[model samples]
Target: MKKYVMAGAISSILSYQACVLAQENQSKSDFSKQSYFLDGFSRNNLDQEKVALSTHASRLVVQLATDYQQGMAIDWADYLFSEKLDGIRAIWTGDRLITRQGTPISAPSWFTDDLPDYAVEGELWAGRNRFEHVMSVVMDDKPDDMEWGSIRYMLFDLPNQPHDFVTRFDALVRFVDQTAAEHIQYVAHFPALSESHVQSLLTKVDQNGGEGLMLRKMTGGYDLGRSDNVLKLKLAIDAEALVIGHVEGKGKHEGRMGSIVVKTDDGKVFKIGTGFTDKQRGTPPEIGSLVTYRYNGYTKNGIPKFARYVRIDKSKQ
Candidate 1:
């Protein structure tokens, strides 16, 4: 099946926030009890040694506007723009394919029967608006024949090329066109000659239930860590994460007010304390399951500064 990639930014705030609430009241002793998604995969050819990603990765976050004002700004429009589909992110590296959190998707042999031996990144989606159910099957690795039948592996970028976003995206579109497979369809990248064009697309995507759009630099090199060049914009929502440590509290809650520690799938730790209600603190999330939190900014020490609990993420981990 041919697959096309849509362009837009992915934000970590929601993901990060979820991790925070997940870790609340949990102690380091519980880390071993957790089933980290990465633990289930085969290590053989797993690219154990991490490579520095390109300077400008495909993770750019796209900014949106309510109304387009001509002659505003453009960040190298070479990147393609597409509706950010809500699906599980997967990275297929030759032998094995895994989710962003490193869970092994038990896709039926038939599901991946047409895949080539290439390093591809895309979403493991079942059907439109079935995100929660789709994630449940893929993350479980249970090899459900009936479940796999409804799924599609929507690939967007090939990792081996070592090209910038623009170059890789162009190649992705061409490859999908050539394959002409029904199961695979290219993620559309709409071109906007003016700001109004961008506004129209954003409105269309949001109304259609998409997360948002990603903006990428065509000529920029891919970077291993997060890059500012790629930004994400979206409506406010809470998320969950793992708690790592605590901070000193202030004011009435001062003695107990420090912040809470949280970690992302990427292993970046931050703090949360500003968004939770008093009731949430009484029954914080367990050490393992996902939880939600909120806050902004990082400290000079590279940790989250202010954050508070929101709720538990009942979604499958």
Candidate 2:
């Protein structure tokens, strides 16, 4: 039995290695034949242009989080929870700041002059419920100096560092304190004790107009993409759907607009009418565009319950 088990394990390892090599070879072949042009510009040329506009911002990528579900398999004691700042994700590559997609933010030199010469990852926050304002400032080709003044770099993790999260967090706090850079600050985190505590914190944050909570595993290393090490906890979940059509307005909504017909990622169709402002109704998300909607949970039929329009998914454009 022992001999058989050993042979099976070795066979499985060899099979996995063969599969990986096959995938890598296929990827290289595809890349060689792939058209360089996408969206009117050569892919290579676009990448080169992005590199030219950025200074040492090409290599950095921020870590992402997965949504937290009830009864998820995570050790709560090993997690630290913090307020999920609804701001633009930025990576400070020691010298300059860049978005997760490697687009260089046109921040003034003074904004980063006092920052340390170490790679840091965090959000470019404006304040509570100021996501639109923050986006307007950072997404511009030429950042407005006055608007940038209100922005803060809320550092959360130090990428590629050898230290664990707690140690890295402490180092970040000390570094920020020594630099005395008002805009460069660390995000405050607390121990996640129990489910009740998590719920209480979520309620408090929501009541204060905050977005949600982020839970990070204390012992996990800084990972590049979405990982189980970090989780996003929210009271109401939001998801993107493709707008297919529109349901005409009625009563108070007459003469303006009505609910939007959308198809969810899983192919479930629904109409979302509530949570739209008058201006948004006047200029509803166009048919065939993508939009985000908020929901408490899914119904028995697998449809999103209490679905309401959140915002147009500008990222899709």
Candidate 3:
């Protein structure tokens, strides 16, 4: 049951042109109908608010990853890297799928009917640069069959397992195959051959519009909350902040949000104004929720320079 990560070397496997084509193929269409997957019987006639709050969340028991630090001491042989999928986190609790906040996500019967009884955690992804679309379809109280069909469940772990990462990943592979679910696949991992290998993978994913890479210790057992065993690597510095207030727009944005004031984990407060679209600006993250933002570095005053809004955390609210 215990083995290692990827057997092959992390080379130029992901084609750049194909990545461009894939990005080009990503939909900018209205959250209109498209794609496949999921089951939708119990939620056949439920309102979005009712379905979204299917469960009350007190804590996020799922294991979380820390931001990767450059030049960190890591024994290459003991760690593995997987593409940090830019999709919402989903926990399949035997019979249904829920967000990290324990909010229910209605899927069609076909989507969950064949999944194993044990809990599995993964990203509900559509593809690169399609985070918004994935959010639209997944957050809906009602299941969008066509859209769900094309969306995928890229599993990274089997929670509550008694084994290390390797065995857990091995178990995940078997579960994926045994179910024969087309929309379900394991997030492939490869050894951290060296810093170069990590950079290569990071570059490829970035070029293809991906966020970054996730590094996990091969020998570590899954632990809830942030752990050094898991880390995130990205080009720009990314972090989550607690929303404290909203700044209204003055001109064209006069009617909607101009920016949001957020407090970082360390208590640094700032406003994220750039990187939001018109649609998103109109509906900013609510107060008391969490939001992920990107920044370059800190200024002399200890503020994140050029902070940009990324995505709002839906788990808290």
Please, what are the lDDT tens digits per residue for candidate 2 over residues 120-198? Answer: 7789887776776887888888877898998888878777665556656656655665675677776755567676778
RMSD of 3: 9.1
lDDT of 2 at 126: 75
Weakest 10 consecutive residues of candidate 3 by summed lDDT? 29-38
**TM-score to true structure, per model:** 0.55, 0.75, 0.78
**How many steric clashes does model 3 contain?**
14
Which segments of model 2 are wrong by more than 4 Å?
1-61
lDDT of 3 by residue, 1-317 (tens): 33232332334443333222233243322101111112222221212221111232554477889987778878876787777888889988777788887778888888888777667889998888788788888888888799898788888887766566766666666566556567777676655767776777678778768888888887888877788878899988877899999999988899999999999989999998888899989888889988889999899999999999988766445
RMSD of each: 14.5, 16.7, 9.1
**Model 1 regions lying over 4 Å from their true place:** 1-76, 178-181, 194-196, 237-239, 242-287, 292-317
Name the candidate, 1 or 2, with the larger lDDT value.
2
TM-score-better candidate, 2 vs 3: 3
